[model samples]
Target: MRTTLSRRSLIAAGASLLAAPALAQSGYPNRQIRIIVAFAPGGATDILGRIVADHLSKAWNTQVIVDNKTGAGGNLGSDLVAKAPPDGYTLLLGTVGSAVTNQFLYKNMPFDSATAFTNVALVGEVANVLAVHPSVPAKTVQEYVALAKSKPGQINYGSPAIGGTGHLAMEYLQSLTGMKVEHIVYRGSSLVLQDLLAGNIPSTMDNLPAYIPHINTGKLRALGVSSAKRWFAMPDVPTIAEQGVPGYDAAPWWYVSGPAGLPPDITKKLSDEIVKGVSSPEVDKRIKDAGCAP
Candidate 1:
């Protein structure tokens, strides 16, 4: 399903946080702030969540922690923040699934993704790479597609979650190329990478960061990237669109958000701090090093 959330809405949606009874601006964050990461600890979400949490902690002179609440394609953790009191203390390092896409993929969402939380700040977008174990026969996108078509549903590929961009990008690839493959869904990219390295899984479409080191070490072969253009970190790897599949761009982004109904002052403060932290030269380089553009 296509997303109704446009680029403009995404930018605006990123400027809010939790809401309800507004806390006094001066005394708002007297306690520790919890930023829930709705995925496993080694994925892009967890990495960026910790960066933002550290920044917030120093900025506010208080403790900020990233709580990993994994399961049900991130709905479990996102729901925790949605139901949290709109005091701004509880926030979410949200992904596309928790923010928008899951609303279409799941039949009965626990919380209204549209109304549950406020968008505090957009972190950055990361490319999803289609990489295979070195043992796989295919070495390029065309080869992979041809191989999948030959084997039909026999080929198994792993992704972080069902509704996640990694999975959707693969689905989009199948729709465009008419190739049938089985999806082996995992809790996060870290786990998928572990299995892929162990030769337990043949291939994966996941965020570029965690796969970069292995791709460089020849543990995995990057067939194509799911971005419009070449990713800076892996410039040698061509985009999916460049390799016979035109218009195949499916980059996922990260953001900070809190329960809906956050006070305007608190929202602005959090948004400003998040934007500042993400834009800092030091943090900027870190994001780039992690294979994402800050």
Candidate 2:
């Protein structure tokens, strides 16, 4: 014979389950929250961080500040947040370079990607554009590939850094096209863009926001975008896959995370707020205008 639980017992069990999340949520983020951007100001990461901080500040009625700590291909800033107190006050605006692919590229990383932090929320992804200086004779993707094939090692391309997403994406393109081209690594995007505009480097893959304005003014010509589909902002631009190379999708993503072992309540609260911020129409429009499909 089976018997149902008494009302008192059932009520107690339900209350216990509810209490756990409530306890986890309490006493979290009692002070200002600091978001660490692993790159310098004027970059995509810094811009996204500021937007998130502003939205969160208004929503939570608490101070949220973005701190730019740039170095070591984003390892310096990421490591700082990884080692910070597990309290909810400290957070990281982690990117694909710092969070997902850094381990594969760097040999002596300070923090272990597996245990350093918990993934809170994915902020968004940014598409990259393959752009060339006006001096290049290529007018379209087909023309560029043909020119590279004919020139072989004579054609050069610049990237923000060696083994960065831009570099790897171009390498993937090379593997597909079976074309040989020289690679030029710059310390940062600013240097890469400056050289590209000055006609020092003929071609480079960079974030769309950084190249879109120049592409519009005819300073640089966009060959294609590095995404699965055409961007909403640049509807006319074809994706690399559509142009020639098949299955060539590469983009950098931004995510929010805190140190490992954060209380479950605090985690939920933070994630909830981030989802809210990213879902806002204003934020969505800003992201779209940046030539990235959020």
User: Candidate 2 on 196-259: residue-level lDDT in tens?
Assistant: 9999999998677777888889999999988888876777888988987888887667778888
**Per-candidate local distance difference test:** 0.87, 0.77
Q: Would you estimate the TM-scores of all the predictions?
A: 0.93, 0.87
What is the model-wide C-alpha lDDT for candidate 1?
A: 0.87
* lDDT tens per residue, model 1, 1-294: 234332424554445433325545858678999999989999998998988888889888999999999988999999999999998999998888988889888999999988898777788778999999999989899999999999999999999888888889999999999999999999888899999999998999999999999999999999999989899999999999999999988988888888989777788778777778878998888889989876
In the predicted model 1, the residue pairs found to clash are: 16-119, 18-259, 18-262, 19-260, 19-261, 19-262, 20-261
* Per-residue lDDT value at 108 in model 1: 94
Collision pairs in model 2: 24-265, 25-265
